[model samples]
Target: MRGSPPLPREFRLVPGRTFVDASVLVRLFDDDEPVRQAAARALVGDLNGPALVVSGPVLAEFAETVMVRLARPLAPVAVRRALTELSELTVVSADASLVLAAADTAEEEELGLRDALTLEAAVLGGCDRLATEAMRHGTVLRGIHVEDPAFGGNE
Candidate 1:
């Protein structure tokens, strides 16, 4: 995910960074449902993260969702800006090791490939906690805590 600053094939958590999954990012900008929209907005607005952790897959996922899943697709420029905003965070590119571990984690956890990959990325990226709706709230996978910030919550 990083090039200019350069990142190792394996990522290391910067100091204090929480892994943010694409679901959270999508919710943050989505307004299809008023209650959920407000919850997402509040979650993000309340976070004053000194630093954040994200992966290449997470950014791509967010871009695709905002561009395709919304009631009206966002303009290319809008999508680009959103991606840029996310990319500005501490970014890590998932590597072969990460994928393999994710596969193991997925199999053990019975999670879909995407969910496992996101969780695996967070663990490998060294985030102590993951903000996502991909798994049960308070569930721990790969030693990383998972939490869904949605008020209405994952249904």
Candidate 2:
């Protein structure tokens, strides 16, 4: 019998490091898109140990996108289960400070509202790296580093 296969490099989940963005989470269930597939694979491969961090805004966005854009409606029971799983991961609440920071980043970096929110969440969570494929390289939003695992570069 074969032993369990090795995990992906991106899924290591290093403790006290690396903040996860909604893009990565959305991909896990989005098989129709190529980018999503890559993101899902990376997370499953390298992020088994570290705490996956997200914000209230991220969760809301995920729910809306999955239900509306994807036209995939999850039952209320399933939604609750998903929330429970997300709670086990690191979820940062959106306080006044976080909102202000996100707003500022959005203005300075010209990022969309959702992207700005994600950036703020990553910073508030003390994440050294923000994993995403949404933004381009060298895109600095209040000093929070945006990284794309699939592309293997920092934004």
Candidate 3:
């Protein structure tokens, strides 16, 4: 699952906003993985850059994982703060076009629906980079550079 589909031709990392994946957000509060937590902090701490882009589904997934699926669920107050903080990012809502694009991505890239959805969301958000641990550390998907900020590959 870490392997990425081939990059599109004429790929370049543009100086645009980053699209964050739920995997990265979940690590922000993951105490078990101190290394990843620090990495997530370092990546998200900088607000000076262009606003990070996220999607409604990504935020919901992050919230649900932290609140219900984690080994130690965060308190209600912590979840609220996390949601509030994430809300500051540019959130893209999924629509029919996005879903259709995701379907094509899934078929073409041989990716699962959710992963394809995330990638398509990033593309729709007009992002140049995707900060995530779910996919390959340094790979281009639909012109967006994927980076695993926690694992130390592409920045």
Candidate 4:
């Protein structure tokens, strides 16, 4: 992914770059939660690269959830197509720096490693917000605000 200079810290109050978590992505194809499905669709309807950020771990989680955890699992080809369609969004790769940062966040936030990785990915990707259903609304981790976009929270 191309690197963009981090925005000034004060820009946090504004809606800028957003990191999407797997929880929201999985809702896109989940027929069981129609309200959330609609909200998820609306949140991502117009988002594109640069403004939208996602990480490798998040994508993998999404793929796994859709394949094995969903009530109606998608075929491999369908999942492949979905992933391909997401190519427009910026994707962050997990690395040594990311792992170390996540480890620190895990201890500091009392979050699991996977959740910490998602938070750290948002910071490393220069995101001002993180949209997910996995964390409490309004929780801030390392300068990124985590919210559940499908509910009553920031997108």
Candidate 5:
């Protein structure tokens, strides 16, 4: 799933880093859809802005999808390296608090557990923006701003 304009190394992200979802994450490496991949590249490689934030669960979900690609599964070492590379962003671990908050988010937002988990992770990470293709673009989740970077929205 590796590609040019690759996920950066040693990138530093502050608390306000925009949270990134797995939808964009997968595109950044997989080349599944060229249009989406370009969008992901544009968003991630926008050097003038802060690096997007990501979390443990987000990377895990991304990994699960990438490891079982229809063409060929990623090697374990590649998966491990990808996870490590993703951790360069501001990442909140999926711990007891996050899971509990996700439960609440699911109940309140009427979202599935995975979606709720993604949103809750953004909130807990102190992010003000969420970059994803999952939600209605530009809709705010409570106070967190949500947008689809794939559609040219800047996080």
Candidate 6:
């Protein structure tokens, strides 16, 4: 069996240094939700990471949910504004190779397609950590650490 890859170098929490996943993004904007508040606080306040990293697929998925389906659907102008602000983040694109990698990761980890894609994007973007509320503690993907900001930090 192949050995697990080495962990990426530890990154100091500086501005522009971490990748923000869809889960965190959803929470950041959903102020009504407690989890979202916690994540937003952790990210925008405490983490102090430089240039948040976001993937194209992640943005598209978030837009579909927050702009299309949510009861208080985001207006086009609002969505555009959000996207523009997010553009300040280091955006990673998912190409053919990354798609294939995501498929492979899904098969290996038994994760759903979206989760696999998220993992692939994080790895490609050279993220040391992926912040999300969806994953449990101690979950590792391609040597990148998965952290649930809501439950983490106290440990």
- Give the top-scoring candidate (lDDT): 4
- lDDT per residue, candidate 5, 1-155, as tens digits? 21112212333223456888998888877655889889887877773334467888789888987888625567779888988878877787788767777777788778888888898777766677788888888777747778787677743
> Per-residue CA lDDT of candidate 6, range 51-125, in tens?
467899889877776787665677888888888877777787888777877888888888888888888778767
**lDDT tens readout by residue for model 4, 1-155:** 21234435733433578889999999999999999999888878766566888899989999999999999999999999989877568888899778887887788889999999998888777788899998888877777888787775554
In terms of lDDT, model 1 sits at 0.74
lDDT of 3 by residue, 1-155 (tens): 32334334422333657888899999988888899988888888764434588899999999999999888889989999989978877787888777777888888888888889999888767778888888888788877898988766465
Find the 10 residues in a row with the least total lDDT in model 1: 1-10
lDDT of model 3 at residue 80?
Answer: 91
- Kindly report which residue pairs in candidate 4 clash with one another: none
Return the top candidate by TM-score: 4
Find the 10 residues in a row with the least total lDDT in model 2: 1-10
Q: Return the lDDT, model 2, position 137.
A: 45
Reference-based lDDT, residue 69, model 6 = 69
Candidate 3 clash pair list: none
Residue by residue across 1-155, what tens digits does model 1's lDDT show?
21123236555554345788888888867777666567667755655554567899999988998899888778889989988777777776888877777777778889998898898778667677788877788877766777777634332
Candidate 3 global lDDT: 0.81
Name the lDDT of candidate 4. Answer: 0.82
Question: Candidates 2 and 6: which is better by lDDT?
Answer: 6
Supply the TM-score for candidate 1: 0.80
lDDT of each: 0.74, 0.66, 0.81, 0.82, 0.74, 0.71
lDDT of candidate 1 at residue 96, scale 0 to 100:
83
Q: Number of clashes in model 3?
A: 0
- Give the alpha carbon lDDT tens digit for every residue of 50-119 in model 2: 4567778778776666666664666667666766777677777887766776777777778887788787
